[model samples]
Target chain A: MISFLQIDLPALLVGTLAALVCALIGNFLMLTRQSMLGDAMGHVVLPGIVIAFMIAASTATWVMLTGAFAAALFASLLVEFLRRSAGVEPSAALGAVFTAMFALGVLLLEQSGVARTSFDVHHILFGNIETAIWPAATGLSSLFDANALANLPPQVARLGFGLFIVALIVILLFKELRVVSFDPVFARTIGISPRLIGAIVVALAALAAVVSLSATGVILLVAMMVCPPATARMLTDDLKTQVLLSLAFALASGLLGYAIAVLLPLGLGYEISLGAAGTIAVVAGVFQLIAMIAGPKRGSPRNA
Target chain B: MTEFREILAVLLLQAGYNTTVVMLGAAALGAATGTVGVFAMLRRRALVADAVAHATLPGVALGFITAVALGFSGKSLPFLLAGSALTAVLSALCIQWIVTHTRLNEDTAIASVLATFFALGVVLLTVIQTLKTGGQAGLDVYLLGATAGMLRSEAITLAAFSFIAAAVVAAFFKELTLVSFDTEYARAHGFPVRVLDLLVLALVLAVIVIGLRVVGLVLIVALLIIPPAAARFWTNHASRMTIVSAIIGAASAYGGAALSAVRPDTPTGPVIVLLAFAILLVSVCFGSARGLVIRALGTQKLPRRVS
Candidate 1:
């Protein structure tokens, strides 16, 4: 049982947690018609991690997370600036920022000789979940698990918990989020500050993304976040129902993808290449395909 | 002085090789993508190029794997490109079918095809890597290319194919333009719009497949988009735009290669993209016909009206 817990639970827990976090934030992105923004932010986070490592000389999660958030915010601000001031297309602005920032991060990494330790950064873009180890004991114990099972490595639990908090907050303010997502002008007319709501959603999405980077890696996270919700949109008209279905789809994919990845060596003659996060993304994509064919007669009304 | 002269001679010789390979390859790919991309852009299918580009990854990997399976003497660049081209064209058609047959909008169809195909590519690539198959580790480099790998043969093939492809475009330029800008007009005019559309798409995928040796798949969309976008800034006529776009594409290829040669670690794709962007900036700001500066300066200041 202990061996089973060690072998099965870790992968299962991490995959499900990643899917939950991605779904929580993904709904907002899909609603805003900014699904690709996750991909842009994923790349933009690189310069932040690089800069943080330069200054901090440590990979402590909090420092890196803050650095990533700041950089992501700056990039988002720059994208908005380009859109407003320069009249550059939004996608063009996104492409420019991510490419330039990715280049800058590479430059910094090479210059600092941190490339040796930091080369895993590229792998971090796609992720390597199998090698990830459980966190050390934090000395905080849950009454339900006196053996401290609840205190399992933060990596296994943090993403799901973070997502739960985000989902709760979103639930509490569901009306505002929906109004702002669909029609900011009308939302503002109703006394909801659309801009504030939009900013909060973008920030939360970014925070969720930063946490996701620890698991899914950067390159693949956008797919994980966007695909499930986008697929969900195809199956339903109700915005609320879409979110619920997307969560179900995402979590189911995580579990199935993890199981197949684990069973690859035994069932197939060869070992599979993808880790849990990638497998989950692949599974989500499969779900989207099935939904496309078997889905309802119409895609949902525009998120607005 | 003697040492300086010898070194200069060697550098100049190498630079010439770099210039020819880069320019020719970019021009061929640029013209092909431009021709196809015009249709894509006019159809408002800009993102499809991105999707197709991503879609090519697994095809390239599979082609490589097949080449290995056959125990080929060489990497079989042409075969690899052909496979990718086939995959890409099929994927593009699948996207079209999904949009038409299913209730899915263009965005969802495109997103689904793009993500699913790319995820498959990533999964296959990882599996191959884990197998320790004797191949390059950064096969993804084919997705994000560095032009330092270009050789003499690739350049010649690109140049020759581009010239032929350009001639085809020139001969059919009027028909292609007619179809791209207004499919309804082309259809009414008795043009074979569907055939022409497929031809243009075929050419574009061909170029993308071949060009992967240099700029790779990810930034290939930039090649397809930026040159035409920049060229559009200079002219409204499709014929002139195609010509100018080809020139810009080749010139950027040259410029990027030259700069990358001097800047040791610089990847050619980003530099080329930057060059294209720079051209766009210039065209946007200073082009004689429709540049921002001229438009802003020429027009009388009017009271701004908010929507």
Candidate 2:
């Protein structure tokens, strides 16, 4: 029993932190209906990392993160410019800008073979989260050892720090985010800058994405950002309840999904585990699907 | 003497018979995607095709594995494509289910399914790649696509499929336009709005399937979206838009194939998409209908959002 606890506890920690950070920012995104922003960032982050590598001349972690954020900003502005000046629809504009940029990134990677050597597109998509959770904590006792905790894998530390920053922002300015999400006009009337607040939310989203990518992978980050909040939204109308419920759902999905990914292969008499990030997405999607059918919130229309 | 011959061969597409077949096949695929993609864009559901494209990944991996299990050449295009078509339709149905059954917005619905299905594909592909046979080589082509390897029979199949799809759209032009413009009005006029909607969806799926073996899934959405969007800059009439889109699609595919042929190892999907985008840029700036430059020079009023 003790051995099982030791094995599962660290995974539970890493999954919770990754899920928490994504969900906190995701709730506001759901209310604002800017989920496409998440999609846009996910694609653009690739080229950002590449260009950053070229300039930094080193594959330092901060350089890649900075490059990713800058690329995302540039891509977002380019999308807007295409829409405003070129008269493209919002979706089409995003599709045009990012696919071109993504393809460009691919070609650049091929030119240098950097994608194969460093980026590992497969690793970015499915992630190495299952073992990340386990290997970070060598044992349950180390959880209480300050020096041991300090020596944890960078993924665990980075995700934990990301959650801290996200939580601080949410708590410090909860009401402003709520108002901006619900009604920007009302927010502006009350001396708040909805646009500014929205920008901050997007910035937080990008930061969360940077931290979450290695743990949850790139495509799975979309699920992490959208699924729990979407489920919470389906379950409640109150913003506060949505936030709290989103946190709870994220915890459940992360732990449950991680556990399933780890144990399922063993059950099948094989040693190979499935990708944790994808399994988590599947679990979250399934939860949302079930909630759509059974939740008491207004997911379904009544027969009038 | 060798250098001159190499240049001449590439210029004439004497690069190989295989190259010629692939080039023409790509053009047909391009034309079909652009024409159908316009209606999808008109309905403002342009990104639904993205979901469909990503969703086909699992079907592809499964189809290959299942074929190998049954003692057939797992790399057979037809069987793999059949699997993809089934799964893409299933994912589409799931999207429809979510839209009707949940309060989630359409973008959210597309994003959810795209992410989920794609993740599943990643898991399956990862597993397949570890197998000692077949897995190490074939399906990676579906990721970025390698057009040179396309068989003559496959090229013929793609060309034939594109012609049939374009013909069906041409035949149903009137009904499709009416429903696309005003669904309730079309229904009141006794046109089957739902069936027309399904037809539009099926057309998009067909473009996705035919485009996959060459263009791959991730970039397949570009083929569906970019051509029609570019064509919209040149005209307001539906038939004219369709024509222009087809031409643009054909031209881009031709251009991309030629480029890929010249450069022996370049991936074809991105080249085609980028070419389509280049035409769009030209169209947006200078096409006659409501081109930005033309409007700026006082030929007509500038376009607003939906124009």
Candidate 3:
């Protein structure tokens, strides 16, 4: 029905954009072998947002974003500190710092009664995009069935545009991200400070989290940041190929999920909450499975 | 003053119940994790636990949705637990398959799994919340948990499960140790290393499920790692480590529950993890083999050669 098409188009658009952005971030995470670090940093953002709200006297979107960004950066720095000084393994150090910080955040939220607020922990974990509208598209029909030209909601369109520009910038500066991801030691020898690159990546990652959290919620943001690139890596080793494959994977999953959610009645009951993020993950997983089994065989054993 | 004593009396009485339930639950969970943590850590799959924990979130969400759809009371702890366990096990299996079939490193495979599954879970959780029409925010409670409301049934189930898990560990102790330290040696000896590995993983999954009610998914991994890690400081033998780890785990559970009871409304799992970490720090400083203070004082007081 025309009505159904109208309803599903926005879901597809937002989901697709979210997945695309996640895949872009995921590529770099995969290359660095810091995939779980995304989850750690994401949870670490909880306290950041809570602190921001506490100080700002409001949960205004920008204020929360700034807080989440600072917290994420702090978590990244904390991990680095633990790794260098405490001699903790990177994953273990991440575990220590983030979990501790999150516990503190939870305690603070409980004390402040933020857990009961509208923009509370629950909403932040699983986002509510139902009321999320594209501000620029007021009184506009962004969907046309004849040519099947489905336009995105205005704000979503802008976000996608911004995301595309960011992706483009990263691509133009691909050398920077690649050098930093591939060999920090070598990059440092050749005048690139891995530390600086790491800081930039962390900053950009936090920025991505801030953007995605509005849609996906804080908990699921890491999925977008880690899944696509990881799946792409299963099929290819080259960084460029991985990024390309990740983007493709993200797009396919987002579109497919949106289509499925449209077709199914469960959308009415449960909202298919994961939307694009879930779809991207599932698709990436499926792609990995296919690549693992059907791809060309290698003679080398696994733990070798 | 009388009102204060009455409140104190009620809390102390509740503390007795909380301590017994939580310690038994933590010990059971700790024993299973200690048994499995050894192999995963030995295999250099330490981060795999993180991945598995992250991946399980979707399963928990899915389980909750399924329970709701089936018209079951949302508070059906067993159903929720079952749903989470099923998804977690499936995720683990998927990870194993990916590792075997793909050229991706263990770390990469685990990371990818962690991300995708967790993302899916987050998205679903968001969707669920958005769609909710009323006051029942069932999913939210599972995030950090409110152990103050833990029922008798939940405690009993954890204890029973823990005992069975411990029994399994005891029966297979020799085989697990042999296989874990040297899978190649086990393979040469025709010890079915793959089967043993699967058994150990199953035990780990069981521990995770049992702990879900108490610690929830996010922090349960901490309990698994910290207790055994602390116990490691005290003992070199695997069996002893498992026993001591369970003791440390149980002590923290009891201690945390008791403290929370006394202090009214403190989070139990974090407190327990803190307690475990405290034990670890203490053992690290004063335990026989690796105690820093003893080593430092030993170095200072050593009978060095006169020359």
Candidate 4:
């Protein structure tokens, strides 16, 4: 139990927190028909981290997070510019910008020889979730100890803060976001700037993506952002219910996935654990699949 | 002076048989992707290829495991690629099903499928690591491509498959153009719009699977997107646009491969993508048809608006 608390608890907390934050913002993204923007942000975060590492000469969490956030913002603005100015379609613009940024990151990573040092390409892709251990924790009692709390992995704190910010933004701007997501022309007539709300939502998503990145990596971040909300969307018609249900789904997937990753191998007599983030993503997918088949609105003609 | 001469030799395909083959293969893959990408973009399915590319991961891992289990070398390119094609097609169908059956939009379906499938691939990869297989070391090349270490057989297979894909696009050119330009009209005229859509997707899958060894999956979508997108700025005519897009794609890939040959540290996939983006940047600014510069020039020639 102590070993599990020391090693598994912090990793699970970080992963679950990451999933929650991403899914929270993902509801709005899905409603706005911009779910792929999460994918783009996830891809652009790589270049941001690589550039941050190059500039700061350090891998501090804040530095990398800031870099990733900036990159995401820049990519978003560039996509907008391409759509408006260059006459590019939104998806193609997004595809071009993010891939180019990602390619740039990979190129910079190779040229800087960072792949040979403390960081590697796989670390950037799959992340180091298994290494997020809280060595100071002894058991459940350690949760109340100040020292133990201080020794908690940085990812847990970052992701916790991210979830708080995302939830706060969603709560505070719920009406405006909904109006813009459902009817931009109506929002404009009512004096709400859809573009500003869109930017805010994109910024919030970038925040969730950058913070979740260390725990879930780029690919799993997209899954967490997309799958949970999509599952919730299938089950519910109300936006609030969708948001709440998505959070529940994200939490459930995280816990179950982490448990399966750790315990399944042991039960089967294997010595190795599966990738926790990937397992979480797969579990989230399963949930979505189930909802698609059996949800109340699954076969509704409203969809057509 | 000698370095310059060597680069020139590489450019001219005089850089030895291995280098020549790899460059040509990349070029062929690029041309095919560009040709197919035109219809995809016209049909607004450009990002579907992104989802398809990402979804190839689990297939690759499964292929590796299955090959090893069957007592074949896990590095068998054919088996691995066959695995990827199966899943790529599966993922496409999943997107179609979700979009058609549910309230979810295409973007949401693409994103969810991409993330889920890639995550499964990652899980399978970890499983592969635990198997103690010696041939599992280079499977990551499918992520970002390592053209420098490509086998001769792999290079030939890539080139041949790419040529076939481009030819397929050429053979179906009129039908595809009609479908992309006027889907409703094509449907009314009795063309199998749905099958052609799948055909476009299948051609895209073919390009991605073959290009996996050179450009890698992550950036292969760029090959399918950037060249055609860049070509769009140069010509309004579909046929000319296809030719221009293919030329741009071929040039970028050929140049990138040669450059990677000259500098072993530079990976092939990123270099090619960067080269393609540079062309896109140039086209966006100064192309003859829809270039920003041309637009600016045309606007300047207009008479001043009355107050």
On a 0 to 1 TM-score scale, where does candidate 3 land against the true structure?
0.77
Give stretches of model 4 more than 4 Å off: A116-118, A139-141, A301-304, B1-8, B302-307
**Model 1 stretches astray by more than 4 angstroms:** A1-12, A60-114, A119-121, A135-165, A179-200, A269-273, A296-304, B1-13, B16-39, B101-103, B178-200, B235-237, B259-267, B282-285, B290-292, B299-307
lDDT of 4 by residue, A1-304 (tens): 9999888888888888888999999998988888988988888888898888888987777898889988887887877777888887777888899999999988888888776764666766775677789999887899899988999988888888888888888899999988998899999999999989988988998898888775668867899889999999888778889889999999999999999999999999976659988899999999999999888876655543
In model 1 chain A, the worst 10-residue window by lDDT is A134-143
- Could you say which candidate leads in DockQ? 4
Ranked candidates, highest DockQ first? 4, 2, 1, 3
Query: Could you report the Cα RMSD, in angstroms, for every candidate shown?
Result: 5.0, 4.0, 5.9, 2.3
Interface RMSD of 3: 4.0
* Selected candidate, larger TM-score, 1 vs 4: 4
DockQ-based class of model 3: acceptable
Off-target runs (Cα >4 Å) in candidate 2 are A1-16, A130-151, A298-304, B1-11, B131-133, B182-188, B261-265, B299-307
Tell me which residue pairs clash in candidate 2.
none
Which pairs of residues collide in candidate 1? Answer: A125-A218, A125-A219, A182-A304
lDDT score, candidate 2: 0.79
What local lDDT does model 2 show for residue B250?
87
Per candidate, the number of residue pairs that clash is: 3, 0, 6, 0
Local distance difference test values of all predictions, in order: 0.68, 0.79, 0.65, 0.87
| Whole-model alpha-carbon lDDT for candidate 4 | 0.87
lDDT of 1 by residue, A1-304 (tens): 4544555566677667777777767888767766666666666787788789889997766877888888988888867764664455555556555655654665566557776775444455456566544343332333246455655555665676567778888899999998887788899788999778878887777777777775667544666677788678778777899898888988888788878777885687775555556676788888877776677734433422
Q: What is the TM-score of each candidate against the true structure?
A: 0.82, 0.89, 0.77, 0.95
Candidate 3 on A1-304: residue-level lDDT in tens? 4444455545556666767776687677666766666666667787887888889977555777789878887877766754563334455556656766666666677678776774555455554434344333333343433233423344355347547766876878789789889788889888988777776666566666666665656544565666566566656657898889878877876676556544454645644444444554556566655666664432124432
**In angstroms, what RMSD does candidate 2 have relative to the true structure?**
4.0
Find the candidate with the highest TM-score and give its number. 4
